[model samples]
Target: MRLPCIEIIGCIAAIVTVLKLVTLDTFVFGDVQETFILFLNVHFLAALMVVFALAISAYKYLRLGIELMPIEKYVFRILISLAAFTGIWALSTEIIRYFNYQELTSAKSVSDIENAKQLA
Candidate 1:
């Protein structure tokens, strides 16, 4: 049996969510490039990709007008929910990591330095 479009979308959302998070980290952590730091922080490029996906999906939905069948509708919901959850998790993780990095890099304390460079 074919899977619902929503479920498929959910899977794609989940994967894309992870990708987005990883890309964000590359910017926030300063691991990617210090020169283009502003670009990463703003994430205009990623935002564009996200907007494109949503726009395409919306356009298709409007054009199809319920021709997606029950499965497809369910898939859409599942996809959207998965993406949302991934986003929440990514944001929280980034915040936590930021503070951890700040404390470590700032030379706040023995523990902070240790914690910050714990991976190193």
Candidate 2:
């Protein structure tokens, strides 16, 4: 079943709205830092979904014997490759951030202990 262009656009808009709602925060009642992190996570998940959908569509086309032109095939391959690379890059960045955060908190706690010892 083919979706009309307007319906597709509406669906995209609705997705964006939901994303906005999920990430919404106010300075009076929320931590901006946490909200930003949540936004990044949401964005990454959306990207992953898009990549998965593209892969599935490509697979379906191939299985159904629907042939793409040479240029189309090249573009599809390039997009898939880029998406995979981006996903890897994002994962690595998040991993590094997690380790850094752990290190920072550990260092802070050690310093706090030292300060407490000095106070005693």
Candidate 3:
């Protein structure tokens, strides 16, 4: 049987996600840069890849075109659901942190402007 495109996509996404997570801290955070620490804390990139992979896998299973053994199907479904949940959780946490950073910066800017106006 021909392998489904979705499965291929999912596998590739999974591999890419692993590579990003492994190399992100080492290459990006290692002795070269320190200023982007906050942005890197987001973890959005890895989580997004995971979610994409899970979504594709889920779609493939839902379509029911690929003939998978019963056990294999069950295993994939469970794994996909669990992975999707984890990805969503990570994504939400990172998004919250990103938004918080934005809010803090905006507030500081507004405060600085107010202080400048008072001085003027």
Which candidate should be chosen as best, given lDDT against the real structure? Answer: 3
Residue-level error in angstroms, candidate 2, position 100: 0.8
Q: What TM-score, over all chains together, does every model reach?
A: 0.46, 0.51, 0.45
Q: Give the per-residue lDDT of model 1 (tens digit) for 1-120.
A: 435666466557746755765565434645423323332444434543554465455455546646777545654554455445545554565465556556555655776778879878
If ranked by TM-score, best first, what sequence of candidates would result?
2, 1, 3
Query: Which tens-of-lDDT digit does each residue in 1-120 have in candidate 3?
Result: 545576566566655564555456223322212232443643555566566766776676667735765544664665476566656566555555655656666888999999999999
Give the C-alpha miss distance for residue 6 in model 3, angstroms.
13
lDDT of 3: 0.58
Which stretches in model 2 have alpha-carbon errors above 4 Å? 1-65
TM-score of 2: 0.51
Q: Candidate 1, after superposition: displacement of residue 108 in Å?
A: 7.1
Native-to-model Cα distance after best TM-score fit, residue 22 in candidate 1, in Å: 7.6
Alpha-carbon local distance difference test for all models: 0.53, 0.50, 0.58
Q: Which should have the higher TM-score, number 2 or number 3?
A: 2
Q: Which stretches of candidate 3 lie over 4 Å from their true place?
A: 2-49, 62-66, 114-118
Q: What is the C-alpha RMSD of each candidate to the true structure, in Å?
A: 8.7, 7.2, 7.0
Worst 10 residues of 1 by lDDT: 31-40
Total clashes, candidate 1?
A: 6
